[model samples]
Target: MSKAPNNQWWRGGVIYQIYPRSFADSNGDGVGDLPGITARLQHVADLGADALWLSPIFKSPMKDFGYDVSDYCDIDPMFGTLEDFRTLVQHAHALGLKVMIDQVLSHTSDQHPWFAQSRASRDNPRADWYVWADAKDDGNPPNNWLSVFGGSAWQWDTRRRQYYLHNFLSSQPDLNFHNPEVVRALLETVKFWLDLGVDGYRLDTAPFYFHDQQLRDNPGRGKATSGDAAFPDVNPYTWQRHIYDKERPENIGFLQQLRALVDQYPDTTMVGEIGTDDSIATMAEYTRGDDRLHMAYSFDLLGADWSSPFLHNLLQRFADKSRGGWPSWALSNHDVPRVGSRWGGPDCNPKLLRLAAVLQMTLRGSPCLYQGDELGLPEAEVAYEDLQDPYGITMWPEFKGRDGCRTPMPWDSTAVDLGFGNHSPKAWLPITGAYRKLAVNLQQRDPDSMLHFYRQLLHWRRSQPVLIKGEQSLLPVHPQVLAYVREHAGERVLCALNFSDRPATLNLPTGLQAAAVLDLPGLQGGRLQGGELAFEAFGGLLLSLA
Candidate 1:
């Protein structure tokens, strides 16, 4: 059953994120494309997702896996033509799924025509299109900024005898948003997509749109930890305070401008990926007053912390600080390791993974589900030679980059490449042999499968309005047991989740009796008897109180 839309379809929406290169390859070529995604649109709708957010599909050099864009206004030939995208959008809309594409607006590939013109000479019409700066007297970069992928954020350009700032790869130069012309041109690109019938955009590295005009060096973090979702020990980029390189004051205005442009198109929205010093606070600020992004998400919950106390505190803190702004929560995405493997350990604990789906769906915000996660797929073991991620390549052995989580989806256990696609050699990334048990065809026949659990959970979530738009409050419970009450318009539901591997017990509050135990499919029932509640390991309970 497809979802029916409201004017504001994003509110409490379940967004399914698809990494195109790994989703499904249609025309072979060893890579997934728009047609492949179009063919699978029914799968998303059947999965009970309200919308689908696709990772970058624009023209790119693939340095950062489609993040470094060479052209914003056209679809990459590898992914098919603009007509293919239009067809995808039409198919998705027919399935009642709003189509949201990734907009990598902060930087462009070094081979971009704009960059080519900007670097031609000092007198070119677009000489100032990028952040070009004269080197210091010692021939060092203008500032001490660092790239999220690795070393210095600035790269020397031989043609102009100057350095250009690149927040990521040296081949991906940061656009000078300080220039009015740059902003205007980018808006035109956005308009092009909007005109083509795209519903929204997942703004990439949103705070990175603007930088410090003076090119000031960032300060050090003495005992402080990293904030850009990177562990300080793994990458030096997280060591600095990052007060000047990104999250500048100028970013808010640009966001407002972008929001205003999209506002012209009805029901069009944006969700920005925020990775600033204080991402939750930034999320609140960026989405506050509905004048900027319709909603925003941060990497705070994307970390390795899966404790009940951590989850409680993070949600509670965001609730306390957000004022009236809405926030989107995601446990997994194309950029991070799959939550099933990341949090569930080597076994990819099925019980815990199922409980997490319930918890994520019940949370008081829109939730995003990563592709392949509904099947309880673990992180694929990619050999060193198969690693294509530059980030993973630079940090090998210790960190495998994101290729493990970005493996192709498994469709049929009996089919070659697990039914991901037919390719000359293989899919973009190899599907883990272990995923054969979790393939869609196999899971479809198993009522207890993770795939069925996700579908049932999402369908049940849609019927519970309180969980959709409720005011959340933490319940005092065992540290390993996360409990919360969701209340809205005189209807209330108590949700309790056991996050451990063993059984747990909690006392029922005085004068409260569960009016009824809600039938949450695929979740083990927690019993309430003798003034106490008993829960199985990784069990979850949803009940109405009298």
Candidate 2:
């Protein structure tokens, strides 16, 4: 099938993130596959998402799930064949949903042929394909760079008598982007997917593409102060400033190369996953111009802060530093606890979930909604016995790992394994009883369900061009209320959200008039009296302004 005509559909678009393993299991193999995803395109389309971003499905050893790629050009058997992937793309496009696959270009599985050959001998043609450095005089790692998954980033290899760099698992070795051949080869792999009519790529660990070439020791800033927000405070990775290990200057040129390649295809784009101490700054740098990334997102919103000031400052910082660059906002994904659990607390109800959905959809950038988030699925509780993520396993009780968020999607509340698969052969991650109660089948029948609310919000958002491409300006409001004005082509919308659990009143900023109140869930019975907007707990209002 021919590609969908390019219209830069990503700008202000809603991209749904689907963790393949949890989305649907077609063959009852207890894993989600390409055919399964293909079969489920209707749900995404019906959800009003403009595109779907699939996590890694490339051939892998399954370490780090599919993030460790053994073969970039092929599909892993667990997911399905390359033909199945093609069928998925075709079907998704047919349903008017763009397909974006995750590309782990910074590293590859140790089992990858290139890594194997690189580690074989010093004189091998591919010896320089991966980062290989000599050990220090004391036979220790070349530097103090730490792996994100824990321990030293350098792993010793006997054959080459050298240590290779891996920002993640030892099995996932970092590729040497300094080698032009390596960059060329990775781009070729990317082109292979584009040739198959894939819409774009979600570049994983994007800022880690290049490292400090001099191999300087990463200067410690007392404690490891910066790490993934999803990680527990106990993981020491957060204490370091991470100067030498990632977000190096050389990465920009590589991104430009990747962007140039994708730009060759119509409407193709790239959204980078940037995790750094100053991710907003790096996000701006990576996407500052049209020559670099099409868009980028950091873990800023994915953290625990849900207050108005926090959200306001986060958006303001991005707007100030991005220098006209676009951003993609996400509240939850496979790597973190679900937002409902993170922000809603133990007693989180539908009112809070609906408020979150409204806030996320009306944000100033393209929004990515994780699978099951539309159903307001809280983070599942995964016991140690059922844990599958290595990062979570390394930290155990202190962290409890990411498996809580990676559980299989519950399709049917009453079906076996929550109707994830036909036979529901022991799922890779068990479905929790709480999650089963929020199953799609059940929510589909409820008009007030979070899922239905998301559909309504997205459909409404699409109709408002101002919401799609507006310039955002923060409005002065009470500390507990988040209010902002989005204006485009003379159309303006005042979005006010009450973050507290009790009634709050927001005095409209002087000179601003509510022309009409947009129809949104949870806004009924709200009153605008004497130039003051009264909101119940977790209430949200979107006002069309004169």
Candidate 3:
């Protein structure tokens, strides 16, 4: 059973995001399972993370990986039984780590019994449980809404001869939040996990919980294209403003109710994933009050723009807009490619990786570290034939999908399959690229390995109280340097990061004094003195101000 409530544990906490399908394989089934995760709980706790967020592990059709949940209450057989999940949760809690599971309440797999019953006939009790609309005069879709995966958001259901809304894959039908019954049912499902002792939920596409009742047409973006989006060049879903499709005003009341339920289990949190065009603002709005989300994360840091000027402006924008809400920052997740490859390139620079890790963990909000990021693993190069992601299959060549990042974790460098499993036919996804060299076993022995750098940074971060709940203020924006001062209880800590490959210097302003240079293990070659700070390439400075 969970211990006494500690509601404030999530504030500035370090959450390690684990992609369950790749973390470990205990059954020799090639695919990872709950037992695999339970066996590896010590790894997360040893890395000094306060919590772990498991990607969706519910019963699913595997169309969109585990994002398309079929059953809200049970674990999939492939991942083992509910007992297995219980064991994983118990083991995690024993290791002093909170467990957060992905909650896919916005939609359900077409294979769900509810969807099957609702589509059987219009007069069924659950007919309105999903967003079903009649075709327009031209027998076309109800509106111009497009699925985030591809083509139309509405699929014609031959049973009712009407269109059902699907913001993602066609197999995943959107739920109708307009129905009070639907809202109640979803909350009941969430309560199941709470009663089961999971710490919280990582709400998938949170803003998408409610959609416009009138089914209005989404307006197209006048000039914007998909150059810097999650799906670039291939997906047209980013061409529109996405106003009516998601982030409706009705969501606030629903979120409040959800929060109320989670609050009952004290210390439990709900961190929403906001992915609309205006994600930062939506994140702030969703988490503005204690009655809504406990915290929320946007795709702001998950993008390609890592320039100091860009980061400085982004932080300022978030600080300016966020009134009292909390945020969770993640540079990479199962959805995006590894930051090492995205930011550092094919043969990623471990120094830059260490620098990025420090920057993320030192940010104002709770930082979520994705699996393999601690090892500085670059994105794997999976062949087209080996691709399993439908998102990539739909938009091949230009965008090869998320399979590159979903490959199995490298546990041992000497093993033929990297020690993921023994007696298995083959790993679900090949352990390709140079990931073997960066395996956990190899890094465990190397004192200066990127893995060790993460352990050092995370362990040290826990000792700093000011970094936890401090008020963040940006320094004067520098073209190549991102700097901020976090103040709490009359104490101030300055964090300055150099985003350039070349050495950089910044002269401190009048009235500011660097009382002492704080020791940040793993991030080397940075000094602060004489009101003039100097940083080596991709270096950082953590100091106390006098």
Candidate 4:
């Protein structure tokens, strides 16, 4: 095993996300556990990713799966014990991989002991641990804010004769970050993991940490502009401009405090998940300096919209703005559909998956690769009865939810349970038939396969200093292709992608013209002709000038 890299290692590095419940199940419980992940550290290390970001294994009631925490310090029994987690971390470090765990700080399960004591009575010792307010005379919620899952964001708690605020399911209540003690306690949780030798944290719903303490109503976001049911026409939350609900200025102070703790540890970093609709702005704010998040990412790249112009505009915006901060890119995660399925149009070729990988690796940000993505795997098709995700069950038929993307990885197609090793005949979620056909064992023997392409491209990227730490300039945007230049100490690399299925030729920008086109998939070089380059269907080009 190689030695672990330094703290700045995450900058422009790749992090693989592991949804622990479905990563691997060593105990035959039909669910993945910490030991399962510990055994698989070699696979992750061999994937060429610099770090591993494990989703929550913390103690939870599973109301919202692991997002709703019951305890901040211990691992959930369903995942494994504390010793199992420590062993996993130790093994990951032994493999030269940094471990980053998910921290769901925005809210806690209604069953959490802290929330239990807080809601016992308004005057209890822990009464102010969560957000609780007096109900209006009409017995309605205290404010107009709505939960992201649906309905009013406030829950009526008869025990305290008050309405507690929740930005998600009623079973998951928002914590009062306004309480200084709550902040101190959460900081202690951060220290707990750091003391355990864990590398860092991925803060979930980071901007939602603080709410409008005055309980002020939010203004409307105006009329609907799209037909997507997720952003429904009748949803009042979308109707309002959520001024007081979240993104409070108070969050900066909290971030500074959090950063101070993180700074105290050597070679540690924090990446936040910002879910605001105006995600680019939020990402910029969260990662604006060394005092806040080391980096932040949003759903801008994870949504259904995929076009050359859209990506061009987004990259241009980031290049022009986002100074003093770093951006993180993720094509798919536990929450969204797999990129191969989402972006693989009817006219797109499977070979283009390698091109997509090249683009993700060469972009001006740290990249996050979801499990099984290297094999060009698509979203698994789960039947209605097989669905266990609350998000999918609540909005079934219209929005199938995230379970399709969270299906277990397929190591050996011929093995029972696709080599996941669950003793029971039925696994938690049914493995996708399409994924079985592209299992790892088959791809491992095929040199031209997407998995092999990822290996070659990642190895090449690791050797290129300019690609890893370079300044970006958004080149002139073309209709069917997006172009950009990454420069470091006078060394330049041009990254261009043909987002459309049809072949298109475009003129290269001035400073990018002299490149010897480096075919990332094959590592071969070609000269640019007539100041223009032609890209095949869904193809991408990374050109380097000698």
Residue-by-residue lDDT tens digits, candidate 2, 1-546 = 233346878989999999999899999988888888888889999999999999999899998999999999999999989989888988998899999999999999999999989999999999999999999999999998989888899999999899999999999999999999999999999999999998889999998988888999887776654545754578767767788888888988989888878888899889999898889998889989888998998888887888888787777888889888999999999888999888887778678778777888887889999999988888898888889999989988788888999988888888878988885648889867888778999999998777888888898789989888988888853578898999999999998888888888988888899988888754542567768999888887888888
Best by TM-score: 3
Candidate ranking under lDDT, highest first, comes to 3, 2, 1, 4
User: All candidates' lDDT scores?
Assistant: 0.87, 0.87, 0.88, 0.81
- What local lDDT does model 2 show for residue 160? 84
User: Taking the candidates one at a time, how many backbone clashes does each contain?
Assistant: 0, 8, 0, 5
The parts of candidate 4 lying over 4 Å away from their true place are 1-6, 223-236, 345-348, 522-527
TM-score of each: 0.96, 0.97, 0.98, 0.95
What is every candidate's alpha-carbon RMSD to the true fold? 2.9, 2.1, 1.9, 3.1
Per-residue error for 311 in candidate 4, Å, reads: 0.7
TM-score of 2: 0.97
Query: Candidate 4 lDDT, tens digit per residue, 409-493?
Result: 8877787677675644467788666777788888888998778888887878898889989988877778887778888988988
Q: Name the TM-score of candidate 1.
A: 0.96
Ranking by TM-score: 3, 2, 1, 4
Model 3 residue 412 CA deviation in Å: 1.0
Off by over 4 Å in 1: 1-6, 222-232, 423-425, 509-513
Estimate the TM-score for candidate 3: 0.98
